[model samples]
Target chain A: MHSIPGRRLIMGLFLIFLLLPIYWLVNMSFKTNAEIVSTMTLWPHTPTLQHYKRIFTDESWYSGYINSLEYVVLNTIISISVALPAAYAFSRYRFLGDKHLFFWLLSNRMAPAAVYALPFFNLYSAIGLFDTPWAVALAHCIFNVPLAVWILEGFVSGVPREIDETAFLDGYSFPRFFIKILVPLIASGIGVAAFFCFMFSWVELLLARTLTSVHAKPIAAIMTRTVSAAGMDWGLLAAAGVLTIIPGALVIWFVRNYIASGFALGRV
Target chain B: MDKTVNQKAWFLVLPVFLVVAFSAVLPLMTVVNYSMQDTFGNNQFFWNGVGWFKELLDPSTDLGGRFLASLGRNLFFSMVILAIEVPLGIVVALSMPRQGWTVAACLVILALPLLIPWNVVGTIWQIFGRPDIGLLGYVLNAIGIDYNYVSNEIDAWVTVIVMDVWHWTSLVALLCYAGLKSIPEAYYQAAQIDGASRWAVFKAIQLPKMNRVLLIAVLLRFMDSFMIYTEPFVVTGGGPGNSTTFVSIELVKIALGQFDLGKAAALSLVYNLIILIVCWIFYTVMTNAGVERKVQAESEPAAKPKSSAALKPATALKPKEGVA
Candidate 1:
């Protein structure tokens, strides 16, 4: 690739802009509340892990992470599983109402979670799924499923139809072909789809907060509520904030090679 | 790319249809129901039939005034965010390192902000903007800028907008980078051979290659920013005198804060409709772009076969996908 002038400087400055606030959060997490309030220190003068320790020791604090992960994992699985077949169909066939169905799905992806939060609360509660990981997981499917389908369809389309015809001619059953031949061929696509499912579900707050109360409260919700109840314990809030970024960071690292292509939804 | 007319393919889509229906259709019906009816205290309810809708649309009414104001704010915010983030994102994407470990490091850092929970993003800025303890606020004050995100309308808007730019610009950059990566090296070789100016090269080659992803980026950014709730809600709490309240914030306040279900439901429908219309426009434009590209590819092969082979994959993959 041809190099642009001052590209390094431009990139360097943008990276710093992104990292500075995060560095502050991490910096604040390690400082005591007294130090946080008393001084504007770039680095924690008396660096401590008390906030981290508190989160680990408190059931309410720790369970929040587990709850968030449980629902996020559940939602990712549900979204990707359903999306796989749908993506194949969309990519390969002209089914009845295919265009309308596809548009409807995309519309749901654009639907504001705030619009759905109340009805989800009512629907989930009526179904006795409220305040469970299941409620949050299912609610998230409204968006994630559409996105998974959209991404996976692009990847599935990239695979030549010749592959499917070959599998069928070789006497492979549809399910077996999907699993044994097709799935492995588009494994990266699935990875990309799952990554997005995980990302959106993990980061979302409005529906997750509405659908769960005590039993399945996500860490994000817990962070907000605890901050309000306990007052601004900046250290604890920052620690919790730092912890939330870890799962995402780890996921991104594992998919680092695919990040750009994945962000393109595999179309690139 | 010829698709068979296989209606049996609907079976493949059944699982998705059922799940999304159970999640989307059911809730939407309930919203429609609530939107048309008024609720008294308790489980007692009576038919108000379009009353809420009337009140919602009329600017003289309290609900209408708040809705219109917040809707305007949301539109302005989305416009501002796109204006700043799009060019900056393209610049950042262009500036991305061509190879090696720095590429990985930069990608990871660029993506970091996007993955943080929205409220935490808000909280980060909230703390990072406090004049007493936050580095950003403290340094600005020390420099005699007299900046505080709280208690000042313009300061609050600036903080929210900057925070959004921080949170989402990476997404735009990542999408553009992906677009740029797909451009064949041959295009650049041709540009260099022709002694193309940098501006001409970008305008002809890079910008065209980046068009599809740029559209996706804009659509996603616009939709998400228009429906923005969590971050600004956390940072400003729609405060410093409701100066930064967007439609979502106001809707939430009506729905959950005040428990005015009827008005909230009506507002929700309108808010969702606006997004749907805008989304439809983008979908149409994007699909049209794909069609236009396909025509170009077909005609270009007849005109000059040499470059068509390189252009095929980029154009072929451009269609049949919606927003991420």
Candidate 2:
């Protein structure tokens, strides 16, 4: 409690630093181009929903949202499923090369995405997986799966082994035992890992854009294409950017309670 | 409890191994293949046999020079980010309240910036740094400083660094905060009994306990910063005369801009190796610290397991079973 005043001052500074960009972004979304270019206004005098309206009505801008959503969801599901058993194995068994294998899996996350971009683009297209949701989904798995494994491994390890044995002793088969006993123990962990997968996959644009042109382009890509003959549509772009935040915000809101604690567990 | 699970544990990990290998090994092989070969469209190849690697490693070549320059800039960016964010994160974490909804709220706010996509972060800064309407830009110009991120090298670097700090400092702060929260109150109480100063308590208690997580934070931030591309790409297009171009940005230019698959592939491999080495070194140091902590903590541990017992209420909790 002695640190109250000091804490407040630090937090106040943090709030300003964190929120200023968001404020500017929201402010710019409402202003007209003429206003944007001519002079700086702290807040738009004439706020309009025109940009938001444009994002919804315009097919080009609208589909980026759709594409991003489809792939991000796909990426999350695949990564989590793969990570589950892997994490369980690492937690439960001391197999040959287990430590080395786990470390090797994590090293994939450290691989520069730029190095793989060209190879992925070429390889996916050659196999007819390019320009599809699965390509991006698969690409994201390279890194996200390892992260999911590392995180969930922590959660799974913390669950007592007695739980697994008891379920088997109760005459449950291995599959039934795992489904009924093991998963619920680590639900918060899975949720936290899933949220991260979704966030990373959603935010990724370079590979998403480079891999697809029209059929699978994401909203980030759509924003890039919006600068047409009419010129850069600041209002519309800002609106689309704002809308992009919604899905992510919803995810954060849902998992906000567990995130801190889950991280604490995962780090251990 | 039994000491062993069945050998069938290998079966559980097999599927993941295959999926990750398919995702990682095959692509990496392809990159390796491309790196060693010379092609002039139409799927044609000439066995170059380390030609591209040699050229890149040499200082005289254009690609080599660019590679070194990008690597230097990447290292510089990582250093700058660590310097600003680590200490700031410590300060923020030190100031954060210990318990209740206020702590949770601060954490949620800290997590918000981390959730936004990389490109969006770049876009936000792009719009937010506009001198005409941007608050920062407007204020800077109002103060008689000529600020233009797109045209000026120093301004571009400044903007990129500031944006990176804003977006990532939260991660450090949160990790440090988590480290701080794990410190039991008995340490503080003991310190109070000893009449220890705030700085002394921090140095002796909190700092040593936080060393492990802080190392993780530093490693993650450094690797991410070294590999950064999307934000700087969107904001400055790696322009203002390449002052803001990092390794990832350079790799993208070689691969996408020039379509030089061979050179790009070689460059990518080199970049990946560099990141791997640095990260491996970081992990080794951190693990060593963990060993030291274990040795140190054994002497004067804080709190009973009762504090964590609250999380595992045996009677209240339900059994869970599912594949995931």
Candidate 3:
């Protein structure tokens, strides 16, 4: 506990810096545009839920959240399922092009979402997958799948080969051993990986926004258009921003340890 | 550690290959196709044949000048971020409490800014920096400092840079903390026994151990910062007279906003090539680091598990699989 005061000071300063914008957004969300512009109070004066009320009651506003959730869930499921077997292979075996294959997968992650935005818009339309959640879900895989594979490969590699040999000796089929034995063993790895897949898919907007229109428009797109269309509804925009953060905050709380430790295990 | 040379393992990777190929390759091929042609509406394209590419690469041309300017801005942004975040991250990671309840608390707080969607981050900051309404803007003005991110170019840049630092420094700090956590206590004990100074211990032990994680942090930050679009877009709209127009922002303007598909495609290919080259550079650097560390192990009998443990868990703690 020596130098406890110093530690407290540094932590205090850092946390305040970290939370200020978030606090302000939340504060602004409770104030009307008039109060927000005219009065500069740390706390909302005449606190109102009108901004949030507008979002909740409006179909365009609320459906944007639903649309975002729809694709993010789909992408997470798709990324994890495909990445599992692929990650398993890279971990356990020396296949042809295995090294090259892994690098290739990761480079796809390095591909800027902007670089592919226009082409994806074209390709999705060509394949008749445009204007739907599937387009964004599938588009997000370009990055999410690579990340999932890398993280899963880490936990997979940590698994001892003797376990596989023992399962075979115990007369378990490959699929049976994999499902009944291997998967149950690395459930944390799956949890960690799924959480990250969900995170990346949820946050992405360039690909998501470009790939979808009204039928599958994301909350982020809705947020941006609101600014341009209705002029800056600072209160409404602030409320939307605050709402978008809740799901992410909840996810972070759930996977705080996994993200901290999982990166240590998975990447470097 | 020796494994079977199974040819059938390709089957396992097939689905991943197909899905990613569908997602990555087909559009990439479209980008390639578009780059080589000129489209003048009505879904008609003529064989421009490197004309757009020529215009894109030559800084003298109108499109090329825009591309070059934005590319320079993006590079500058990446450089500035690396400069600020890398050192700040190390200091923060060092200050972080290594054990007890604080670990979870620190992780959750640090993780908050990162998990926010990019556009929301922009919106949050946009409001936070408003002169009339924003706390930051209001506070700065109250303090008699001139600050207006809306109209001033330098202010816009500073605001964008600060927002990025706030949003991403935690990622670097978190990665560094993980690296610091993996350092075996024996290294410290050995240093203390030798009467090494704190700087000496950090130089010889902590710095080397952090090299790999630092590489990961740097590469990830570099790529992400270079490709930044949405956050800055929402905040400034690349405004104040193209002061904040990054390549991605410029590309979108050309391709989607202006409907200049051919020029956008050409520019996209160039951008992709640059990013690929960066990835290659970092990949090779990391691989060489791995190989050099391996060579050092082979030459020194003192190196533990010299021949193996080079890839997974080189100096990392083995992840607990007993959780299940």
| DockQ top scorer | 1
Better of 2 and 3 by TM-score: 3
> Lowest-scoring 10 consecutive residues by lDDT in candidate 1 chain A?
A224-233
- Measured with C-alpha atoms, the lDDT of residue B301 in candidate 3 is 63
lDDT of each: 0.91, 0.82, 0.86
Residue-level lDDT tens digits of model 1 in A150-194: 999989988999999999999999999999999999999899899
How close is every model to the real structure, measured as TM-score? Answer: 0.96, 0.92, 0.93
Q: Of models 1 and 2, which has the larger DockQ?
A: 1
Stretches of candidate 1 off by over 4 Å are A228-230, B305-324
Error of 3 at B184 (Å): 1.9
Candidate number that wins on lDDT, 1 or 2 = 1
Ranking by lDDT: 1, 3, 2
Task: State the DockQ of every prediction.
Answer: 0.84, 0.61, 0.64
Give one digit per residue, the lDDT tens place, for model 3 in A119-151: 898899999999899999999999999999988
Tens digits of lDDT, candidate 2, B285-310: 86587567667557433433544322
Would you list the clashing residue pairs of candidate 3? none
Q: Which portions of model 3 show Cα errors greater than 4 Å?
A: A1-7, A228-230, B291-324
- First chain TM-score in every candidate? 0.98, 0.95, 0.95
Worst 10 residues of 3 chain A by lDDT: A1-10
RMSD of each: 4.6, 7.1, 5.5
- Report residue B49 deviation for candidate 3 (angstroms): 0.8
